[model samples]
Target: MFDVLQVGQQHGTSTDRSRIGAEPVLLSLSPTIVGSRGGAMVTMRSGQAAQAALREEHWQEMERFGDFLTDEDLAALPQTIRDGLIGVRRPGGMRYPAFQIVNWGDGTKEVPPAWLQLVELLAPAGWNDEFLILWTSAPNAYLEGASPAQTIQSFPTEVTAELRYAAERAIPTRPGGPGSWQ
Candidate 1:
């Protein structure tokens, strides 16, 4: 069984703490478990600390994608190419992830055709940009613990197959007619 961390009341004055309410909440992520006579002791960050850590981790992960293209930067590209790129909403505005772009020594950049194909496969799901980004970057069980973004370059076929399966799963199907009770 997975170890669980029980977080007590937060110590900070930030309003984010109130969101956790008066009760201590349990979390399973990154828990530190220790054996004791009673049972076990689990240590974890407070709500505020966990939130801060999550924000920092998100910022660092976004940094790994290289430079994010702003509206002005994207406007420099042709409309067709711009439309094919994946852009996520941020605090300021829409920022395009440049992971698909291959930069040449001459300063020109090109988006891989395979990346566009992957985007096309996921388009029918109508997932938001943030979800798309997370889905690609996060470790997927369907991909055997490898993130789609990590293996897409070397294992395009496998990634494509997984994406197709995910798309099919996302489609809602009715088991029977709406009027039917059983």
Candidate 2:
């Protein structure tokens, strides 16, 4: 949690309240933008901190999850936004599209060369996003739930994730046992 604003102002300030000699009173503040103010402090208890909260179970699950995918399977994941796999992973459902990066030339069954269109795919955890073709050679996938589109054709580049895949990356605990390469 973060205190939007904490100012010591005068409690009894009439209509003509000025920055003159007035008693100190706690001021309620709501920040329009986070981390913007005078000595703003964000406090969180243990096991609640963003970094520490990632439980060990989630990490182990992801490690096991990673093992299922072969090098070819990992490499087979959609590299382009227009091209994504038919089935990936879902919590309870059968399958879902997992955002990934792939090459355009390396056409697969799901995405053919003719169907090279800018598309959207959910990121890890859950996200409303669009897949973008980074440089023609190496494309990177990103999720955009707040904005309108996926590609950052606008002036300011937007690279932010509204959701997360939980322990897929942060835990560092291997999932899926081992890959074929290993």
Task: Find the candidate with the highest lDDT and give its number.
Answer: 1
- Using alpha carbons, what is the TM-score of model 2? 0.20
Best of the candidates, TM-score: 1
Q: What's the distance in Å from true for residue 121, model 1?
A: 2.3
Give the 10-residue window scoring lowest on summed lDDT in candidate 1.
173-182
lDDT string, candidate 1, 26-102, tens digits: 43444443333347654444554576567557745776665478888888887766766787776678877665565
- In Å, residue 128's CA in model 1 sits off its true spot by 1.7
CA RMSD, predictions in order = 12.6, 17.9
lDDT of 2 by residue, 107-179 (tens): 5333322213222222222322211211111223323232212222221122223212211232233444221
Candidate 2 regions with alpha-carbon error over 4 angstroms: 1-44, 67-182
Off by over 4 Å in 1: 1-60, 64-67, 103-108, 155-159, 162-182
Quantify how close model 1 is to the true structure by its C-alpha RMSD in Å: 12.6
- Give the alpha-carbon lDDT of every model: 0.61, 0.31
**Candidate 1, position 25, lDDT:** 48
